[model samples]
Target: MSTGIVLHHLVDSRSQRVLWLLASPLSGEELQIPYTLKIYQRTPTKQAPPELAQVHPLGKSPVITDGDLVVAESGAIVEYLLQKYGNGRFQPPSEGLVKNIYYTHYAEGTLQNLLSNWRIYGMIGERAPWPLTYLSRIIMSKAQHAVLLPTIEASTAMVEKDLEESKTIWFAGGSEPTSADFMMLLPLEILPRAMGERIPKKIKEWVDAAHRRPAYQRALKAGGEYAYAKLLPEASEQ
Candidate 1:
């Protein structure tokens, strides 16, 4: 059918998840939600280009236009597609639905913020003038150890425990990937490398599984040069 979907994709942004979600196959069938992809380049500073502002006032990525309707935010775009085009796919049954909903928001609402704070602290330290660089690094390191790593470690443990207890690979305890998987992928995948900590074995496996998916590979090829694309050789190694 004709899906008037136009995905405004920015390289290496959360928008990649939207592309993967759209390309994900359900019950051995394609979503067929064909759309145009308007790729925008990030500036040298890694900020989204101003052209995105034309698509949505915030000018950030992970936005889409379905005919006259404009939707932004990774979570919003995922939900919009699931509601209109999912046809009851990529969602868990009632028993798993609550977990699904929690994780869907948790990725951006909770997890990503923590990850961003860690990155910001590091950036501040790196960009500080030479005179202050040493002091800045010490301060940032202290802040990370004091304020961020504890929470981050606890959150990761919580997820690992949940996955272990349920004996389910995906977070929502479903056989196939769900919206929760789509949302959680980036944060979990980036966690170990981003934080320089070894993620729990189960979480590492989950990330590897996600990367090995056909749809995810397709998304990488279509989206172009994702920083988080499965590391060389195999994602399993990382």
Candidate 2:
């Protein structure tokens, strides 16, 4: 297959999973892959990049173009990459186990969305002035921490259980890494950095191990500056 993978990049978003898979241990020089990574600059005035819309009607990040194939959604992209380039390495040996864990993998989006919303609300509450901000915080607090937090907590607990139950270094029954690990690791890796003191130590260790990989480091170097730029605009100014 003479297909090339082009990834729509937005730092710390679902697109990172695609980058991780491309840079995963399984991929090698033999793959003869020529991939393009498109990064969209996030600004207060602008929305998603126009190129994203050309690739996918929704104009979402993490869209990929592989030869004639166009795929959107992070989960579908991960699965496509795994099937095409993974060489059957990341999948579980037992079909039943794969089926069981697949739902947990899917649930990551829900958890991530809740976390993002909470963070957004927190920022709004802290920065926005006057009664409107306070009102917004009250509404978001009830919606997020009160209603959504429990769901995210339960999901995290489930992931922890799966990780503990796994016999191998990765969730997908292998001594090495897999797409499943790549998928789970991105958010798991970034949350601590984004949330700071709120993250637990055990999750920190997991993120550290995953980040130790050369591919992950490459991905970080590739686009991590943008996210860091958001965090510390002074650094960028300097």
Candidate 3:
């Protein structure tokens, strides 16, 4: 008895994971729920376009409009889906859950933030003049090494530990994808581009498993040109 929702999606944004969630509900009519997709392309600088700001002041991707309700932020959108449509699937009850609840917060703010810093410094190094910017490049490299790279390393290790100890290919959920998988996939899928040789086996396995899901492929097909979707060889969609 919920109104149809409108997802304001960006091709390579965190919205991709939300697309997966909508395409693949763990159970019930979540998939059958009426929803529409509003696609936005990034500007030349790889940032969300100004048009998105009209939807909300912040103008970030992954915003949803359900009737008069406008929701922004990936984590909040996931929670909204779970509340309105999940029907107690893909997560545990509100109390006494660790990874399930913890990830909803950390996935966007902490994990993505670390990776963004790496990209920022890399961009700085790229734009720095080769001969004239030698000193600038050194400073940027030092800054990257001193802060961003270490943070990515530590976060990567923490995710590895969480996966290895959980004994589940997916993050918090046991043997099956959860809301955490949807939230966490954004970071893991980018490992090939973000970290390259530093990609961990456990994370690769997790992502491979996700790729194999028919729903994931369908989402990718509809979502269009996800920058990191092909990082690893994805299974052919059936």
The most accurate candidate by TM-score is 1
| Order by TM-score, highest first | 1, 3, 2
Regions of model 1 farther than 4 Å from truth: 1-3, 26-31, 231-238
Ten consecutive residues with minimal summed lDDT in candidate 3?
229-238
RMSD of each: 2.6, 5.2, 3.3
lDDT for 98 (candidate 3): 79
Clashes of 1: 0
Which one wins on lDDT? 1
Candidate 3 ranges beyond 4 A from true positions: 1-3, 26-31, 93-96, 128-132, 234-238
| TM-scores of all predicted structures | 0.92, 0.79, 0.88
lDDT of each: 0.82, 0.64, 0.78
> How much is the lDDT of residue 142 in candidate 3?
87
- The digit string of per-residue lDDT tens for model 3 on 42-85 reads 99998999989988789899898888889998888998888888
Candidate 1, residues 1-238, lDDT tens digits: the string is 2357888999988898888887677412665666787888899999999999998999999999998889999999888888888888877867788888999999999998888888899899788999999999999989988999998999999888877865478877877888888998888866864556567767777888888889888888889768765532244666
Better of 1 and 2 by lDDT: 1
Positional deviation of residue 232's Cα in model 2 after best superposition, in angstroms: 17
Q: With candidate 3 superimposed using the best TM-score fit, by how many Å does residue 168's alpha carbon deviate from the native?
A: 2.6
